[model samples]
Target: VNQLGIGNYLNFKDRLRHKNGKLKYVEGSAHRLDAQNIQVMFNDVTSRVVAEQQIAEERNFVFHSLDVMPGIFYVINHEGRFLRWNRQTEEISGYTAEELRHITSAEMIAPELRAKHKEFVASILSGARWEGEAELCCKDGRRIPYYYVVRHFKWQGEDCVVGMGVDLTERNQAERLALTYLKEMQSLSARILESQEEERRRIARELHDELGQGLTATLLSLKNAEEQMGESPMVAQVKHASSIITILTQQVRALSLNLRPSVLDDLGLVAAFRWYIRERVESAGLRVVLSVDKDLPRLPALQETACFRVLQSAFTNILRHAQAQEAQVSLRQADGNLVLVIHDNGRGFDVKAARQTALAGKSLGLLGMEERVRLVGGVLEITSAPGQGSEVRVVLPMG
Candidate 1:
C-alpha cells in the first residue's frame, strides 16, 4: 500500500538528490533495526558524500586556473614528493607532470643552493613559509632567474609544502646590463680626464720655459734702449713703451705659472700642495692649514701627480665657490691606501648640482679630478650642501 502511493506521488531518486545535495547525506528510515547498524550506515554515507563534493570543488579550481594563470602551480606531499602540478608547469619547465613526479625537488634547485634549498624545505614543513628569488633550469639547458614563492599546506591527508614560481630572467638580465653600462661610463670618463690633465701640463711647460722667458728678455732690451734715448722728442713715447713692455713681461710669467706650477713636478705632491695652498690662503686673505703623514714616503710619480691634480682642482673650486676664510687639507695613509681630504669652511654648492655639472659639458673640473684618480685606480668623492662647507676626498691604492 505504501509503495503504490509513493511511486505515484514521489520518486526515490528525486528524494535522494534533494536530501544528499543539501546535507551531503540522508537518514535511514526508522524501524525496529539495531541502533549500531543505523548509526554506522549514517556515518559512512555522510563521510563519503562530503569528501566527494570537496574533491570536485578542488578539481574545478585547479583545472580552471592552471592554463589561465601566469605562474606555475604545484603541490608536494609530506614525503617531499611531487604529488601534482598544473599543466602550466610543463609549459614553463618543458617537463610534463608525469616526468616531474619521478624526480625529487632537489633536482630543480641549482647546485650552489641545494643545501640551502633542503634547509628551507625542512623549515617550511616545520611551520615556516620559505620564499625567495631562486634560479630555475629550463628544458633547453638554460638557467634562468625566477621569483619563487612557497608556503606550507596540506596534501593527500598529510602536511606538505608547495610553491609557485614566475620567470624573471629578462628583467634581472636587463638590470645587470644597466649596472655594467654605468660602470663602463664612469671608467671612460675617468680616463678622458686623466689624459686632459697630461695635455694641460705639457702646454704649461711649453709656455713657461719657452715663451715666457723669451718675452721677458725682449722687454728688458727695450727698457735699456729707451733709457739711452732720454730728453729726445720721442722720450715720453719711449717711456710709455718701456712701461708697457715691463707689464707685458710680468703678465706672461704669471700666466705661465698659473697654467702649470713648476713646483709640482720639482717637489712631490705634498710639497707642491703646501706651496699652492699657501699662495691661495694669502691671496684670498684666508688662513690655511696643511696636515700630512710625515712618515709616508714618496709615492709613485704618476700617483703623486694624480693626487696633486685632485688637490689642485679642489682649491680651484674653493677659490671660486667656497666663501669661507679658513681651509684645511689633510693627506694620510691608512689601510694601505693614500687618503687625501680637502675641507673648506666656505659657501658650499649643491652636491646634485655638482654631479649634474659633471654630467654636463661644464663638468671638466670634476671629470678631471676623477680621471687623475682613476689612472692609479683611485676613487674620488665630493660632499657638500648649501651653506655648509664642501669636502673633497680621494683614496688611491698605494700599489
Candidate 2:
C-alpha cells in the first residue's frame, strides 16, 4: 500500500525531464499507465535525498559550533528533562551525555539553586528568553559563577529550553571586589568630610570667642587710652593705631564667622540662619525675609548642619550670581518633613548653564549642597531657567 501510494511519483517527473512536452501537472495520488509515474517517483526520491543532506549539514554546523565553545550547551524539555548536550557540556559539568540524560535539571543543580533554575526554566518555556548570571555547584561540589542565555524553542513538537552558559567565576569575583573597594573609598570620603566639618566648627568657635573677643577688647582699650591722653606727643600715633586695630579685629571676626558661625551652636539652625540672612543678604544689598516655624522640635546635629550649609551656599550664589534685589529663606516642618526653600528675585540663568559654569571653574555650589543632603538621606531639588528665578528646595526626612 505504501509503494502504491507513491509509485506514480517515479514517472511524474520523468515525463517532464526526458520525455516530450506532453507532460502536465497532476495533484492527486496515483496516475494510470496513460501518464507515467516513473518521472514523478524519481523526482520525489531526488527531493528526499536533498532534504536529508540539508538536515545533515545543519546538524553538523550546530553541533560543531557548540563543541568549539568553552561553555556548556544543552536542550531540555518543558518538564526540565534533558534532551541533548554537546561535548563541552561534559567537560564543564563532568557528566557524559548518557549520565545527563538520566538526570533532571534539578538533580544536577544544587538544592539551593534548584528553585531559581526552575523559575528560569518556567519563564523560558513560556516563550520568554532568560539571560542571567548565577553561581551553580559543579559536579565536585564547587560553586562557580556562570553567565547564561536561554532561548525557548520546540524540539520534536514539544516545548524545550535551549541555552549556552560560560563560566564567569573569576571575572565576577573581581568585579564584586572592585565594587566593595569603591564603596569603602566613598565611605571614607563621607567620614573625612564629616570630621573636617567638626574640626572647622571647633576652630571657628575658638577664634570667635577667644581670639576675636580678646582683640576686640584690646582695640577698645587702646581707643580709651587715646581719648584720655588728650593730645600727648604720641596721641596721633596711638589714635591711628587704635583705628587700624579696630579694622583688623572686625575683618578677623568676619573670617571666623565665615568659617563656622558661633550662633549656629548657640541659637540652633533657625536663629543662626536668621542672623546669616540679615547680614549676608543686607551686605549683598538684597532685601531678605526669614521665616522659621514657631514650635519645631530640635533636629539632629547632622541634619541641622546640612540644612544650614545648603542655605549658606544658596545665599552665596545669590550674592555672586543672582544679582537679585530680594531673597527669602523659609524653614518649616510640614507633613513630617523639614522643608527649606530659598527664593530670589535675581537674574536667574539656566541650571544646565550654571552646571556648565561649574564645569568651567565657576562653582555651582550644588555638588557640596547635594553631597550634604545625600549624606543625611534627604533630597535637594534645584529649579531654574533663563530669566526665571531659582527655587532651591530641600526635603529632609524627619525622625
Candidate 3:
C-alpha cells in the first residue's frame, strides 16, 4: 500500500488482485479506510462544480446587460489604462476594444483639456466623485460632448475607476441655436423701433405732398369764384373748384385705406386676407391661392395680427426675391396649434446663410417674421435651396 492525497490528511492506495488474476490500484484500501471521509470528499467536489456554474452564469448576465446599456460604461485601472468597457463606450469614442486597452484615458481627452482631466481623475481616485460635462476626443478626430459620472472602485484588488456617461451633442446643439435666436431677437427689437419712426415719416410726407396741395388749390378756386359772382367767369371758376374737391376726396380715401385697412377690423382675418390677395397680389400679375380651415376658432386680436404680418412679410419676400408665377398660403389647426404655410415655386436661397445674413441686419424682413411668430409662443421654419422652391412654415400655440 502507498499514501495518496485526495481531500483528506491521509489516504491509502493498495494493489488488489481481481478474480481473473489481474492486478489493479484500488482507491478504497483497508489500510485505515473510512467511508465517511470518502463521502465527504465526494460532496466537496460536487458543491464546487455547482458553485462554479452559478458564478459563470452570473458573470455572463452582467456582461450582456452592460453591452446593451444606453450610456457608456467603462472601467480604468490605477495607471489610467482601460481595463474594460461596454459597447457604447466603443461606439461613442470610435475606438475598438483592442485599441482602447492599449491607450490611457488621457489619450481620449482633448489635447487642450488633458491637464484638467488628469487632475479630475486624480481627485476621483482620492475618493471624491467627479461629475461634470466635458468633451471626449474621438478616434476620427472629432470631439464628442458628454456628461459623465465617475467614482473610485476596487477591481480585482487593484485601484480603479468605473464611470458612466451620456452624450450631450444634441443638447449642446439646441442650446447654441437658442442663443443665436436670442441675438436675432435683440437685433429685431432695435429694428422695430426704427421701422416705426420711418413709417410715421412716410405717412407725413404722403399727406403733405398729395392731400395738402389738393386742398390749397381748391381753396384758391373758391375764392376766385366768389369775386366774380353772376359773371361767366364765375361759373367757370365754380366748375374748376368742384373738380379740385372731387380729386382731393379720392386721394384722402386712398391714404386712409393705406394706413389701416378698415376691412381687417370689420370683417376679421379671412375677409381681410381675401380682399388683400385680390387687390394687391392679383393686381401685380402674380397667381395667388388662399386656403383657410372652416372650423377654425376665433383667435385673439394679437394672434390674428401676428399671423397677418408674418403672411404679409412672406408675400413681399416672394415678390422681391422669388420670380415665381404662383404662390400658395394656407392656415389650419394641427396638434393643438395653428399652423401657417406659405410656398412659392420660385428661385430659392440657402436658408442657413440667409438666416445668418438676416440676423446680421442685412435682411430685417426675415428676422421680423421669426420674431413675430416667437412673440406669440410659436416657431418659424424656412426651408429652401438654390433652384428649389421655398417654403415658410409657422406654428402658433392656440391658447
Candidate 4:
C-alpha cells in the first residue's frame, strides 16, 4: 500500500483469512484511482498453488531416488544436451553437475567411439531401443567400460533419450581372470598328457626289450633240452613247458605293441595309422579304408601323438560300441592344418547323451579323445545319432 501511488498498480499473492477462519491463498491487484481513493481486486488461487508445490515435491523425490541408484541414470535431449542425470554420472565421469550440463553426451564417450555412439543415439531417436557396450571417457583420462540400454521418449514436449548404464569393470576383469585360468589349465593338461605318453613309451620299450627277450631265450633253452632228452619221460614235460613259454612270449609281445606301437616312433604317423588299421581294425572284422595325402609332411612330435591317440580312441569306440561293418579314416594337410577324420557306419549313440555321461565320469573315451586334441590346440568334433553313423573330425594348426 505504501509503494502504490496515483497511476501506479501492483500485483501480489498473499494469504488471507477466509470466512470459515481458514487461511487461503489469493492473487490480488491494487491501483490508486486517485490520491485519496484506491481500487483493489483479489482472486482465490489456493488450488493452483497447492498443485505446483506437489509437483515440485514429486520431482525432487524422483531426483533423490535416481541419485541413490547403483547404475548410471540419465536423460538427454535429441540434440544430446543433458537434461537430467544421477549422481553416479558425475562421479564416474569426474565432472561436476554444472560441467556436465555444458558438455554433450558424445564428449563423454571415448574419442574413437564417438562415431559409433552417434549412430547408436540416432537409432534410439528413430524409436528403437538400443543396448550395447562402450568405453566412457572421464575427465581424469580414465576409460571405464559400460553397458547401457537407452530408449527414445518425450519429456516436456521435447525429444529425449532416457538410459541406464551398468559398469562392466568387474565383469571384464572376471572374464580376463577366467581366461587366464583356462589357459593355465590347458597348459597343465598338455604337460600331463605328454608325460603319460612318455611313460607309456618307456614301459613298452622295457616290455619288448627285456621281458620279451627273456621269454624267448627261456623257450629256446627248453627246446634244446627236449632235443637232448632222447625219448625220456622228462622229454614230454619239457615239450609242454616250451609250448606254455611260447604262448606267454607271444602275449607279452602283443601287450608291448598295444601299449605304444613301435611303428609310431620309427615310421611316422601315416605308416603307424596303416599298421593300426591292418592290425587292429581289420582284426575286429570292420572293413576299413585308409586315405593319406602323398605330400603330407611329418608334423611336430606332439601333434603327431595327439592325432594318433585321437584316431586310436575313435577306433576303439567304434569297435567296442559302434558295432559297425565299414569305416573310413583319412589324414591330410589342408589350409595349413593337419586334418584327421574317422567315419564309421554303424548304430550310433546320442552324442549329447554320451558327452553328458562322460562329464559324469560314466564314460571317458570321448573325453580322452577331446582332451588330446585340445591339448595340441586343435578342435575335435563328433557327430552321431541313433541309427546313423558317427564321424570324428580333428583339425590341428600346423603352425
Query: lDDT per prediction?
Result: 0.75, 0.79, 0.77, 0.90
Best candidate, TM-score: 4
Per-residue CA lDDT of model 3 for 124-167, tens digit only, reads 88899878887888899998898999999888888889998888
Candidate 1: regions farther than 4 A off: 1-73, 129-131, 154-158, 233-236, 300-302, 347-376, 383-388
What is candidate 2's lDDT per residue for 368-388, written digit by digit as tens? Answer: 888788778799998987678
The candidate, 2 or 3, that scores higher on TM-score is: 2
Residue-by-residue lDDT tens digits, candidate 1, 1-399: 243333322222111454446543554432223323221122226666678889999999877887678877777765557877777777877887778988767766677876666677778888987677887776666777778888998776778888888878778889999989978987786567557657777877777677767776776777777788777788787778777867776776667656667777777777777777777555777678889898777788779878987887888778776878888889999999999988988888898877788888876888777767876789999898888999999999988
The candidate, 1 or 2, that scores higher on lDDT is 2
lDDT of 4 at 184: 98
Q: For residues 305-389, what per-residue lDDT tens digits would candidate 4 score against the true structure?
A: 9899988889999999998999999988889999999999999999999999999999899899998888888999999999999
By TM-score, the better pick of 1 and 4 is 4
Candidate 3 TM-score, C-alpha based: 0.49
TM-score of 4: 0.84
In model 3, what is the error at residue 131, expressed in angstroms? 7.6
- Where's the lowest-lDDT run of ten residues in candidate 1? 6-15
